[model samples]
Target: MRLFPHPFAALVVLVTLGAAAQTPSSPVGSVSPTTGLVLRDDVVRALIHESSGDRIHDGVQRLALLARDNAGGYTEAAVWTKAAAEAAGLKDVRLEPMKQGPQWRATRGELWVAGPQRYRVTSHADLPMSLAIKSGSFEGADLELVDVGTGTQDAEYAGKDLKGKVVLTRGHPSATLRRAVTKLGAVGVVSSYSTPPWNLPHRLDGDFPDQVGWAIVPPGLVPEGQPAPFLFMVSDRQGRELRAQLLTGPVKVDVHVATEEYPGHYGILSGVIPGTRAGEEVVLTAHLDHYKPGADDNASGSATLLELVRTYTTLIRQGVLPPPVRTLRVLWLPEFEGTREWFALHGADPVRRVAHFNFDMLGASLSRAHSRFLVSYTPDWNGSFVNAVSESTVAFMNRFNGVAYPPRKDFRIGSVTGSRDPLDAHLDRYSRGSDHQLFNDHGIPGVAFSTWPDDTYHTSGDRPELVDPTQLHRAAFAGLSSITVAAWAEGPGALDLARLVAVHGARRVAEDEFRARRDLASAPATGVAGMHRLARAVVRAAYQRERDALLSCVQLGAPAKAVRTMTQSLERAEAQALERLDADSKARGVSLKEPAPSEAERRARAFVPRRVKGQELASFDELVTRAAPEDQPRVATVQAALREATTALRERGEGELRFYQLPDALASYADGKRSVADIRDAAYAEYGHVFPVEALMDLFGLLERGGIMTTAR
Candidate 1:
């Protein structure tokens, strides 16, 4: 039940197939804790089979063209998405617009190595990704090209005079800007960046020498009184060539970049399939924006979502599937910003929203990209039955889709247009990078289904042809299976779901209980009171989260009588978890009571923070820019701590936190009731890492100062 999320996609099929092979005479049904309804296995599989990789593959091709054309950007994709949704037979398809800062796009851009043997380096007309997004226009002729290796640290440019020069660095454009341009004097920027393992540290990048990364050059990145600079994103080979030239002699560079920023609105293309229950909804989301040929990054996500809309609506229309108990609303929107705006501005009621399933980068050539499909679920703080529901669904695939001839043996569903590669999927630890975070932040539990460590991630090589249809088919099938289950958590099916939740809830409770015991045993030298406090969080969180997951079934319209019965099961789970603590205390020969709050905890309890709308910070560096100069250093320290807490020390052979998840855990835990200390505790309980309370307060204070947060209503 506790499967690992690891780099090796090759897991023996025998483990999960054990149960799935024992097919029920009648296809097994999922019951809900509340409604006691049932959705038959045969019906669910039939609905999922409607997902066509062929259609998804074609969708990606069309979308890639729209993405490649800078003239259209996200709005263009939204327009296409609106039409696609309507054609797919989704009711009430529309493009919802949200106000946003001006959009930036490149018109014309070119870089050249000026000399006797003059040669053009790169151009926007040739490769649009060559120009970093939001880079301002600049024109310079025969300027010095300074080679500052990486340009991240001061030592990179310690004695070099970068004034009126193009600083060619193989670092992130933002880092180069922050250190080289913002602090040091540099006129122009060019980056030859490679993908590094940020979250899934165990994964490795392929030898993508020609891949040019998509980097950002936001406004205010440069110092005051400096010329607004332009950024060129060149391939690793191109950058190495330029760096070598600079080392040989004083290399002169000629550049001309033309770009424009216009007032743009974040567009979200959406449509809903009406359900038996009016207001209650199950939201399926996938981002639509990324650089050209971004097939794997998100065109694949958007395409697969389009297939879902098409498949589901068509099935229901044909009476092959009944109307869902809850409305199924599909969204194809820009990444983080669009999702946030929709949740904040649109009607968002946590009680009414049943679950959210976000698909990002679902398509990947398993062998080529060195990719594995990942199912990253909600943190325990957002405790909902969705985790158990999705987990079981994915676990089901771990068995159902296997290579075999014997009864209950390996089964694979392949498409002619798709690759024959096995569906390499795993249930990864929650690492947020897509639209699912907004749903969790809004208090509705969610999960993200995607692939990672992609060689073409955020690069020019993420082409449509490279996106495997078989992977897309598998992702679509797996995702649809979960979505359909959530959609129909009504009547007898709802009660069956409740049972499923109980099964998974018990697994989690047991895992947490074991962890609590382990924690206590690891610190045996401490006094009874100290020991009680140390294990208290783990034990308490386990019981608390599982209880909530069971109770969440009530949101799906479960009957009171059924819930009462389910509550008894929860009591059992709670009792089992408490037994571990009780046994530990008995062994220690001291009575254990909840430890009193420390000074930090007491301060955190009183200080409740609420997010302020309309003030969004993009990154840690951007957040630092908003803080007062003195507070900026504190923000920097917080950033450093956050980085350390999220990334695992792979050298120790430890597989713990995945870096990207920190922002979601920090952002989502700040509801009205939870104080700074409460959020901190939840984060620690969710992830084993201890994020300092002081560090959290520092970041929270900056959020408030930047108008992204306020202490209270």
Candidate 2:
């Protein structure tokens, strides 16, 4: 039966339920005066009490059984996902066909060392990851093993004959296969690129000493007219043993890989919870494809999404919660490829998509996997209030589940079955890896929920036993609460969200101010102007972010009074931040005003900036490689400088080293309508600082020389 008779009826029911759920003591829809947050006591209580970790665990267990090895596995996952969603009473459950690349499946594979003391190594029948994905079929063949440490560079294979041999290397399988097997005529490859240093002890001393991880053979990387080579990943322990044997004398091995490639469609399982609004929707997504027993990597995420569906369905059916005003759409698909295909088909009409919440690797056991839950924000290019909302929800959950100050205090809100360990989740800057990247690329604001530093990630050791049900429960709650509040936010709830944005904005401004001060203090006199420019730019970005948040509330149909109040609050905060920045500038004797560009600089600005399209643009590695022959000394200097800069940036909490300042920011401003000068000026307006004309010229010249940009006209 339908949950509501009509759209209007659904709206009325939601309003009525909101009114009924309120109480005098802790009103459900009341705004907290101190925190400026909506107190959704009823919804929080329901989520805490009704959400089931056991159900999440059961789903992960069932999914763990599926090998998910081929197109068949992908189809099987879709079928099961559809069935589960239907059983949960979700509406419009169906499988969407995604036509992308050919399907790859490993039917059988085995490896053994035959010479100088023979022994069995591993088999695909035992562990799917033993054979890398896209490995070709090969019968039993005795090939000598050659040690070519990280066979990616030509120097590594200078004096070696790798013909008809199995190359052993510690580099990525794809890179090694391309260089060793395809170029050097090796029969196969064995890679031992294990987990990071933190996970070394686990593999060395743990029960799964022979555990391996999955690798891929990229078709694009192979030499033209040469078929992809067979590859396998083995444990570091096994690899070490083989290398030791090779040290004494030549070691021969028998390798067999049975695999097939065929055409197949990617599957996307989707279930909808219809709401009062017809067009507007919020999507919850999780990838379902992975190696066999891929529990912590992705089975955990899929299971959490399934549990969320069941909980929402049950609550609505039981009359404990009303239907959302905006439709809630849950989707399961393969990772990047599937999401890309989905966008290719449905990207034209994305105006109704409120937000996309992506879940990946959300159930790793902290003690075993050394995992930390992370909620990554949307990129600055696609800034919205969604980041603030999601971050706030995670913080709220931490209050109850986070490490207590006094220790062992019962601070949890509602009774729920799971771990009492602190929620220890952190908010991270935007990164590109999973399905969320595709959404963000299509102009949709999205967030990704994941656990990092997982020792068992993407490895054979990522079994269902490594999943923590409590982690799953908490992740599901954060996602559900954020999306639910976003869908139903109006009146007091909308006001509270605006306030949340204001608070978050203030904190962000403070962080920028701190960074500016540090940069100014450390910069040399010659570089002081650039530093000041960057600091001003940071302030401008911060205020713009606040404005974006307030505008998002307006888009959400928030009450005018609430939006006005929030806008004024944001303006006041921005003004105060600017005043402080000016005061600091005066104290530092730095000029805030920019000088007018000379005629030469103005002429330089006339050059239109257009990003290069299509393939064959040289990669950074290729650039370094090509430069080595022309200018060895220059290359060494550049490399050393880069290393030093990287070290400094890492110390400053900037995880990745960026040699150029504001590459993405500059690129964002390089629309066809904007000239180089126009783009620079606009960037300055947005950032409150402009790079020196010479610096801008050098950046644009480099882009043009590298074929990454060109004159539009």
lDDT of 1 by residue, 1-713 (tens): 74875534445455456644543332226552322323465565565467788889998998887653343677778888888888988888888777756677778899999999999999887777788877778888999988888776778887898887888988767788777666666877888885654623533333567888787776677655654678898888899899788778999989998888777676778889888777788999988878887888788888988888888877766556767778888888778867877866675354388799999998888778887878886777777878887777666665555442213322355566877665557776566667776677666778998887676777788898888887888888877778877887665566677788877777877877777677676664445665555466776777677768877877676665787787787777676667767777778766555467777667777888876544332344456656778786877778788767745434434343355646535766665677887777677666766677878877777766766677863
Per-candidate TM-scores read 0.86, 0.82
Best by TM-score: 1
Which 10-residue span in candidate 1 carries the lowest summed lDDT? Answer: 402-411
What local distance difference test score does each model get? 0.73, 0.70
TM value for model 2: 0.82
How well does candidate 2 score on lDDT at residue 4?
48
Q: In candidate 2, what are the lDDT values of residues 466-543, reduced to their tens digit?
A: 787778877887777777767766555666667677777678767766766666677666566656666665666667
